[model samples]
Target: MLNAFRARFWDLALGSAMTVLFALSGTAVALPLAVAQLLPLFWRRRFPAAALLIVGSATAAHTVLGMARAIGFFPATIALYTAATHGSPRVKWVLCPAVGVAMAAASAVRHGPVEGLLMAIVTVTVAWLAGMERSEHLRQRMERAAAEDRERLARRVHDSLARTVTVMLLQTEALRATTPLDSAAEQRIDTVLGAGRSALAEVREALAAAGSGPALGPRLEMLRGAGLRISGHPPARLPAPLQDITDRLITEAATNALRHDGPGTLLTITTVPGDGTLTVRLTTEPGGSASGSQRAGGGFGLVSLTADIHGYGGELTFGSRHPAGWQLEATFPALVPGHD
Candidate 1:
């Protein structure tokens, strides 16, 4: 409501100021001609083409009267600018040139033909160009803002939900291998794995649409390279976001294990998928040269990861395990709402 009032105030102010200027100009037809040209300023933005026509017609009348001064000049220029900025392309192209011709003809009657025509054409051209430049700048600014927002969302998705998904895939694969199951049970596990892969693909597509940089790639391999022995095979593909989260979790666990318990620490990761939820556990056992306590501080990475997990209705916990190890566990929805 306040914005509407502010806009109306400016429109009335411009029109009234122009009207008063012409009234005090001491020309015979100045007051009436200025009123006709400037009155449309109130609706110039809302009905640009019509406003331009009204202002242009008054300008033409001012020219025909052979007034020594062009009282309609300022109002006509403002109307032309509004048309170029807000009017439809067809209306803008058609009306703008017509207004320019009228102004040039008026100027020619008042001054020398060549000088007046060039001056009026230059003035009209400048106003139109200014409006076009402003429109382009606004468009570019909006695009930049949208791109930034997409990038931020992509990062959050990758860090939290994607990591959780990766752990689920790894654990499911492990469960298939170590435990003998009936054919029906095996098929169900395969379906779950397939769904995990599909979810990952969707995350990749979303990141691509957002124009984020390169994929994180093969988190399982990354963990193995960090000297953690792998007991289970990951699915053929994992979603980019989940893969990133899994990588961070595994990396942080491995680092803490090696740092606190010396090199050659054993790390175990497991996943259990229930009715509508999935649980992941990462345990670290001290190496031969173990020294410090297993209670590691929750760093910024874990804090951020915790927030991300909670955002999707998940829970996370990490601490010293028994008398000999450290463990981190998280449980979250198997499929986040609205994601499928």
Candidate 2:
């Protein structure tokens, strides 16, 4: 019950001060008059500035009021100063000194000099603090916005580089088996293949080094849910985020296999985790040579794979057996290997 009254009184006091500050922006009145006029604002409002202004105004006005009571002029001013702070701008900084002097002059015929100076000093200090706090709030909001942009950029890099390179490695391997006897063409293919592998390696390193932070766990769960045909023993000890990255890569490789081959075709996937890296082996059976129809129906999965693996500094390679299946192989730095 007492809390409620305290709240109500603060509101009234604050509101009264703000109303007077806003209303009394013109020519200077005596500080004592301003305080007496604005003091009621505290009872009706909760703002700190309004409360501060009221107290400062009251202090300045007290001198004017005391003198009038001693002399034979107007009634003595009753200045009530309260303590509080608020979110809004302070009006008392401008009002207190100006009003204090004017009101003092009016009361000079009655009240004396000493008290007016003290009131002027207190009003200005409270107003300064309110302004500084407001600026800090604005600065914090801007920093939050900048951090969001960096996260978006990181997601984009994941989609483009790692995913693409993996699919391309698959396509190159398919071509390796069917190509005719042309020595120059094979050399050119080797050069292109070497460059592609190098690009894949660089991208994977970046991804591995970045270390996923908060995003690692969710990404792993998503890949595990995807339709990946797993045959080997499930890993018993893998860092959650790194395990997730590998799972996602496997899921994406499975997607490419389905995109290229009919559902009935067999796909074998193997993962070899070593001292500081992991090797992925995927073999998909083709009913025939990867033909014009297959090439025309290009898969952009490679682009996605490239982006994902690039950040981890991984490498991917492809080859095909004459008997009809294609192979996709990739190596990743074992589980964000750098940080450990």
User: Which stretches of candidate 2 lie above 4 Å from their native place?
Assistant: 1-237, 286-298, 335-340
Give candidate 1 misplaced runs (Cα > 4 Å): 1-5, 27-32, 67-71, 159-161, 177-180, 211-340
Error (Å) of candidate 2 at residue 309 is: 1.8
Q: Per-residue lDDT of 180-270 in model 2, one digit per residue for the tens?
A: 8489888988887898899889776666654443343443344445433333432334444345455555555555655556444445767
Per-prediction TM-score, please? 0.56, 0.30
In candidate 1, what are the lDDT values of residues 278-332, reduced to their tens digit? 5677887765656537565687878887886675457889988776878888876
Among all windows of 10 consecutive residues in model 1, the one with the lowest summed lDDT is 233-242
- Report model 1's TM-score to 2 decimal places: 0.56
Q: Which whole-number lDDT from 0 to 100 does residue 294 have in model 1?
A: 51
